[model samples]
Target chain A: MATNIAKIACAVAFAAGVAAPVTAAAKSSTVTAIEERGTLLCSGHNGSYFGFVEVNDKNEWKGLDIDMCRALTTAILGDPDKAQIVPLSWAQRFPALQSGDVDVIIKATGWTMGRDTEVGLQFSLPYFFGGTQFMAHGDLGITEAKELDGGTICVEAGTTIERLAGNYLKTLGIEHTMVSYEKASELRAAYLANRCDAFAAWGPFLAVLRATELEKPDAHIILSDQLSNEPIAAAMRQGDEEFVDMVNWMIAALLIAEEEGVTSANVEEMASNPPNPKIARLLGVDPGMGERLGIRDTWAKEMIAATGNFGEIYDRNLGEGSPYKLERGLNNLWSHGGVLYAPILD
Target chain B: MDAAALKLRRSRRDMLVQTLLVVFVVLVIWVAISTAHTNLTELNMTSGFGFLERATGWSYSFSLIDRSIDDSYSKTLLIGFLNTLFLGLICIVLSTILGFAIGTARDARQLGLNSLATVYIQIFRNLPLILQLVFWYAVLIHMPGPRQAFTMGEVAFLSNRGLMLPGFNVSPTVVLAMFAAVVLLAVVIFRQKSLQPVQKLLLWLVSGSGAMLLLAWIFAPADSSIFSIPAQQGLRFRGGIGVPIELVAMILAITLYGSAYIAEVVRGGLNEVPSGLTEAGKALGLSSRAIWFHVKVPMALRTIMPPLGNQWIFIMKATTLGVAIGFSDLFYIVSTSITQSGQTLELMGLLMLSFLLINYSLAQLVNFMNARLALKGH
Candidate 1:
């Protein structure tokens, strides 16, 4: 009798184990999951990436990436406050997303072919454009990156900047050593301590550091050469076409809103009295855009009202409205001599 | 029932139970692999060891082997393993010596010395190792830069970059001769009682030849100078062996932390030694020094070996703290590989296997030493 009961228990456990993955696979979309959980998990930087992702004096997250995460959360769950930021290191971001620790990776992640194909990440449309550059001490008397020979260069590990810097140096036939740290804070510390001759990182981040973190800002010189132009985007796990499309269009709505002269303050006015069909459709006055994407018809309006348009976000975090006061450069609108454009929303 | 019949039935039951256990474990493993495979396929990620052959377009700060952006992942990982092994071995040797000294000092008759040893152990052993590592790293990097390096008679330079020492330009033949001299010295020391007269004479000849080769290499003509002193060039010191600051900081932290633990192990082992044996040695007219070395240490070693082995393994594992300081050790390399190659499972498996092989060898060595030092029966 005991043997029979043991056999039955073992059989039941085996059956349950076999059924688990199948049930997990049958789940339809990430949107439903977010709705059920009532919070949208978005990735944030482990340390401050000033102007992109950092805390303010008030101890609140305020940056371009943080605004993007809030916009995504608002679009999905209709409340920006429902966003939960999960801080992750550069190496931990991919694994965190793959293991379902976060819903979307809105960190300042570069879209590379290796990350796209090999790492199994599905990226949304490019939201920000930037370039990689090097910063060196003024005492080195070196003006160009090519002059940094037989010196050590510090960079953040598990980043595209590390690879780009190495490749660029090798292409110029310059010999140097590369040291990488896992956190931006550690990299900054090493560079400041003069442990390495030069530091390599994203261009805007280098500028921000020079302006804010450095006591003697003129003591360091950012080299003029652009190593590589990176298209920064949001990454999610693959095999969810509906979720990917929603995120992609959510980014498009922001750009279109910016181009159509719609601000967070004027979004409600524009929706109530849109002069053209494009603005009407974008603000959900026509109602088909949101239904097709499996969301409320006023999703775009809610998202814009929560996190303003793309231009406002750029200005508030990184451009004239912030301490960095950086130029838009390649991040400007397509009509204004930039590469960013959204497809026509019909 | 007969006793033999009952024994046979019990053996049959044991066999059946063992078979069931094996089957259950195998089934569980199979289920796990299948699930993982299915999930990976759905995510469009490949899972295999094939990614090891792909080019790793990154560079490490310090590597024993020649590496480049074009090198394959396998080569990079091998260099990382070598770096870790080298660091672990150096720390093990230094900590053992330091631990023995401190442990002996702890048992000293002098109160001040004993208290000093006690304080050192308490401070280092109680502090977290990661904090210690970060502290040492901060101290090292805060030193003066290369241009203002603290020079040791211009032969060696200490700077935030590293301790740059004057390197030798010896030929391969000189290195080979030096190796041969060490091997011959070991043979002479280990087999002195059993060596024939002719063998001893041959050993002497080899040692003499090795010494002559080294002297010749050292005194080669002025144009072919054997010493390469570090001199400031461009952004750093050139023409000498440059040891990066990361390696120095990692070794210092691991050695200090590991020594504290090992000192305690030594103290326990020595305390547990039978005091009657020391009294016996004294009664036999042994001198104080002779009694301490010949009576106390050997007996303590038998008890010390097992725990000392554990400390050695722990020290090796602690080398992973290299990542915190950006020392390009095996764990750091494998983690970077996971991000670059996206073969997380395979890379992680490789890392675990490599560490297991390393620590297992260390454990076996400890066991062998314990056996050799153990008390023997008549």
Candidate 2:
């Protein structure tokens, strides 16, 4: 009863906070809708997808994709705290975005051709690169994926991993059974219980599960086999070019900052010191681009202070600083032997 | 007011209400269709049933019909429908038997047995079915692998993969002889008025023994084995009947959960029977067993069945929860297809239609049984 009362109180306080900006947001571009409301509505996973999205012990949402929401909110509304994460299932994600229930979705959604063309949503530049990877019990003397011939593979339903595993095994002429669960956590549990011979998921997600969720980390081995590329990106409703452009550039700023050797700790100093013409332009040393994007002169700097550069976000949520300790393999900067690149500020 | 003026006012009011209702219903449908159309167009989505012909591109773990991953979606949905129906029917039968036993036990004179039944109903009824399914699934999956399964002699084995039991491959001659024996026994029993008791007993013993000998003789063939036990081959148990662990867990959880509700229904119906009926049976010189069975049971059944019918429908709906524990039923398969094909509306329509057909058939059966039970003494 106390909890229910507390919940009602919180809801009342939140509604009171939202009332003023909502009337101001009624007639404007979606960007103004976000700015006036002082909140960036983001759709994310209902449960922890490990490093992608999860609510922490402090009752705050945390993860790499969540950091993206923080970045965009800080860039647009100038307040990192002005962001709301709406939990959604895989099937619910697109519908929620289409219904305007959410401003954007940064829930490790794979940018598919079908979704791009058929779904009523627009995707930002790929923020994370992943692929379907297989993990097997270390007790099984299987070193290669081909060794899993005729083995049952556990996977989450309605995911690319299911189709990828099926197609990959079929190409090898290896007949296998696939048991699909609705949630990733359920799939992981089944795998832990020895229900399947191999567990298939995105490489980074599997890494996070093995590193953190497992009691015996070394008991499982993720094979180095890549089944299909899964380029994760953010999605929003179409017909809002200003909102789309703003979202895209927020992603680009992170990459550009990383390229310019600007860390969140050093961004303020870089803005005053004027490291180079490119860095200066990115930091709004000569401010005009902010006006063009309809943001503040120090928008990029504020965004960096709120979250961090792409590398910092990656390291903090998924890499060296996180339990997963995933290396920025294909997600590294373009100049660093990876595919990620930001267009020049010029 | 006079009668003519009052009647005219009443007709006008009735006409106004009828017109308003028709307009309201049409407006609702129009809004619904337009919203769907606008949403689809804005999202750039195509709507049709043509995708059903496309290959499923994934295989299910358990299927009643022979199907490959490359089969059409229609065929996949059919396989899923059959699996759901199979599980639903099995749970209904098992839960009914368990329910009656527990209900009777709850009413038993033995204090210990009554308490035991009470505890079962409390535990299962209070807990949700999904949680029970996951719990049972976890327990099953933690069992030893196929190679090191807990074995029962050479005929049965239990493992994380499934339960394997002995399968019989009887010869045609043995089956025919068994049928002939059944026919002879029926003839002797039906003619009991003409035949002596000794004659009837003698005939039964002869036919039964002849059927047994015939089965033994047929099984003595040196060329083929009649009884096949599952053997561990590679990573799986092969040869005998293999019941997947998921299916077992789903059935166990569903039956246990459903039987609790069924027990309550039965207990309520039985208790509602008048004590006078039992006293009347005693006055008529009926045994206790006969009094309960012939007098009270039939009376309770009329009350028991309607609620039991409701419980049956509940079980049918609960079968969809099998998807949570990786039991591949119709709802699970369609949900998977929706995620893959991005055809949510069409697939959902198909799922609802299939369930509607299934539940309607079940309701019809329940109604038929209820009607028969509603009739009196005959």
Candidate 3:
């Protein structure tokens, strides 16, 4: 009887210990440090890969990640000026975060296992979803990435693109050589020099490169086939649950903005009026919604005013207004049959 | 009556020496580790070595190993270590040669040669090594495409991507012949060492090496057929050696930077040697070159060994600049390893340890050389 009771006790103890993790998992996510600092610290790339991250004539960073930072800043501080963007290369991004150099990283990073389990980071939510693709100079008549058998490729160092490209080549049983350089500039130099048969990179980047950097934009074409589906997100150090939630909700808000008719031009008027109870709540026409997120009722309104609506942001940073000229495909609202779908506002 | 005096006498010397010894030990360790440990852990991160086993599923643009991102971070690090070693060995040999030329030129009487030496040293020394690296990379990477690549006699090729040339693709017959050549060279060197004078032995070695190389070229049989990438196509290249521009830049930086300082050291060492030593040798009917070689430089070697070793540590540390060009040397690979493993502290420690090992080994080598070559009476 004593042994059985002890056994039962041990089982109960094990169950309790296992169940204890629920609170621990929920506890580390406080965005208080970010709120106190009054700025969203974001680390991004230095290059003008175009539409992604680039420095303007004044030498300030501006791009998709920059816009996201603006949106989050407006959400938290009721002012867009509360966001600071720190530039880092592929090698510098993680160390900066691990050392508290930056609050979060929204650089062009793929959500990988090592980054999560090994690095002790929380990848809050994927903002931009895409994959690796290859592009060849049109004159080579290399229609497919597979057609470049025994050809050479140029890629940047500290990226997953090289591995992905190699995997595809291996699958097709084609012989190829991959040359890498430390910076994007070096890779681009090699590409322009005609050292590589193809330049392998992300889809959006290829489009941006063609639009902006090329001497003749139409001289090259990106292969339609994607080698990998990368779900990139804003990342922060583990144990900052509140900050993670804030960034996660910020990404969801972008989808919600698309779902609603809240363009940057029309957001002010819409916030004043009411199409639905949800928009009023989201725009803080109602009082309770903003409090739940630990912000002022005018938080959404300020965010919209600072960076424009989701549609405006996309258009400005990556769409028709920007040089990339990308169409909103799966990134559109669920009602429009794209991948973006945010939950209904409470 | 004498007890107090004795106590005072012992303590003043003992306590001071003890204190000095403790301070030295503590300070050395503190300087070695405190910064890396403190800066890394403050952000809720811990340092340790658990990251070596985790999967790294990425591929490098330039790799010595068949690494995929799927391989362990440890593998990438190993590959990077090998690259650094190859670069270090090459730069050491090249800088030694360049240093000799520069040191010789500095005091030379020939007006044109002196001016050229001065120009070479000024140009290379004035430019930052990293800037030089970037410049070299820029020149190489921005060149026109392969079809438009500069070609020499339809054999050597250069393009922005990388240079491709005819490499010896080795067959089994070539391997056997290489082994035979190695054995023959070894036998020749052994005979020269055992039976001949030093000068005569050196002559024998040069001839032996030349004959072996000639035979290998003839028997190893490089394909005069269509050229391939300078690196081996399937595995590693046997005959065709490709020095990638990234590697070229790093070597250039390390060698050019290191050689300038070495030249200064050599000059200083030579100046310290008594002029009478050479005059004595000449009086004894020894040649001027032989007098300088057999007596002066050997003595100078002892005086300069420690500083040379210190420069080597700097060279090893400066190799971290390879990160800029993506050569994946110790620093570059360590950073990537940190990124993949999330074991930042452990990997950082590992990196420091690796550098410590490299520095320690180089120091040991210099110390050994200094000890063996130290003057007998001193």
Candidate 4:
């Protein structure tokens, strides 16, 4: 009887402890409406590479990934800066979302069944795509990854790249030891220091390292190995279909922006008077579809204004202005013979 | 009341309270453990020590163990423990010597030498451990490759990869000479302790240097071929013993950090001796050294042993940071284990226990020493 009372007392105390924050987050996640204020809690990468989540000299966060986070903010709050970026590591990212640390995860996280079913996080449209590639210092004359029959390869520890590197090496009948590092930065350092004969990292990161590490800047090359698929995209926890729909539609709309020649500079004008009926309807000229998503019809327009159109954001971060200087291969628009497809906004 | 009756009552009351406390603890443990068990189980997480038997199928980038992915988790854990011990032993030995030097130098009355000691401590303390590890791994290890090493008369080869030195070969003559040299060195030291001042100092220096030279010259021809490490080899650098850069850098950092504190402890020990003892030595017509050997060192140890233990424990923890520098110590092995075996919970538990053993055992050892050195029987 006494022990039961003690257990009851402890349960009551624990319940009391979790009561307030749970209530607040519960209110924050109420359906599709705003929680308390005009804000959207978006999570992002603390450190990835280049256009995704590059750190400047002052240690400030800004990149294409930041643009993706801003889009969600503008979608709900009519302002992009309202989104808060909660940069998380690969290990911490899933736990952060499952625990409601943020409303969404817009980091360069890959979509997979194990993560989806196991962690209960739902994937949105792919914001970008990349694959693993083999890179080496140009002087090694190792233009292809297959030539590394008796060489050393470097990869980030505890990542998919380790397994992919192993499988690819096996396929190529190569005999190489995979030197795993805890972080991409360490792997890059080791590769540059010539500790390893070759580097196995994502292609975009290879481009970034090339821009930074190489003397002639073409001193390293990322071979067309395509070791594994990295279908990188945004994610939110399960049981938030309203939030999912809002984010998904906005993505489709952004892809349509590319299809309809909508630049960040031209987005505002396009929103005011989009020529086509579908674009007009999407701009909320005909009838506000925002009513269904519990927002004003001009929500996406607000998102675009805060950042830019999909094409503008892409060009700024991964294109000529950025150090990555990626050539928009698979990430380009449908009209450009790429995989980025957008359904009719109507 | 009678004395026996009073003692019986007290004992009974003590037993009742102890029983109640045990019951209380048991209940608390029950709740916490049940909560963890239920939550983890419901979350489809299995927890057991059975994961130790599973094969950890993966290749290590850098490790102390020749691990196949086929090595069991238990083997991985043991490898991790050994790595920790390797780093710990090296760091502890270096720190003890470095700490003594730094500690003594701190008490040196000279302005420049004292300030240099101060500067050494300050500069190292100011830098973050991780940054230092990176700098060591990158800048220090980036020195010379295997072939491009700097050789000093073929006796010493310093490279970015390692520092190579000629370790003596163990032929019967060489071994016998070294053994004799050690015995003679000890006898000379002990005899010098009791001899007259000027004569003792002269004999100690002469015999020590002479014995060292005699052995060196006697073994010179054998040393030329057998003792001296061959500078040239086809693939692996042969003959010369190679000490890895990772080992050097970790030892250097741990010793540098540990020694500063050891120096401070040493200074405190030196300061603990009353000035009157030295004055008494002068009054009794004794030299300055006699008072120090008897009065100061004994008392200083009482103050020194505790903090020295704490510094060693810090070293044990600091070895974990060796993972950052590619030294496959406890943390590195645990990480590799977790990734390869997928036994996150079991590996985590093992990691915690391994570190706890190292730290707790070190504390126990220090405590034992402190007790031995404590003022005899209160």
Query: What is the lDDT of every predicted structure here?
Result: 0.88, 0.85, 0.72, 0.73
Residue-wise C-alpha lDDT for candidate 3, range B51-75, written one tens digit per residue: 6777665555556545555577777
DockQ of 4: 0.14
Could you give candidate 3's per-residue lDDT for residues A2-101 as a string of tens digits?
9999999999999998787564433223356677777777786766646777887776888888888878878877778877878788888899998877
Which DockQ-derived CAPRI band holds candidate 2? acceptable
Q: Return the DockQ of model 2.
A: 0.44
What ranking emerges by lDDT with the best candidate at the front?
Answer: 1, 2, 4, 3
Model 3 captures what fraction of native contacts?
Answer: 0.43
Please identify which of the two predictions, 1 or 4, would achieve the higher lDDT against the true structure. 1
Interface RMSD of 2: 1.2
Please report the candidate that would top DockQ against the real structure.
Answer: 1
Tell me each candidate's TM-score: 0.68, 0.62, 0.61, 0.57
DockQ (CA atoms), all models: 0.59, 0.44, 0.22, 0.14
- lDDT of model 1 at position A181: 94
Highest lDDT scorer: 1
Name model 2 segments beyond 4 Å from true.
A1-130, A230-346, B1-27, B168-228, B283-285, B376-378
Instruction: Record all residue pairs in model 2 with backbone atoms less than 3 Å apart, i.e. clashing.
Output: A120-B43
Ordered by DockQ, highest first, the candidates read 1, 2, 3, 4
RMSD of each: 13.2, 14.4, 11.8, 13.7
TM-score of chain A of 3: 0.74
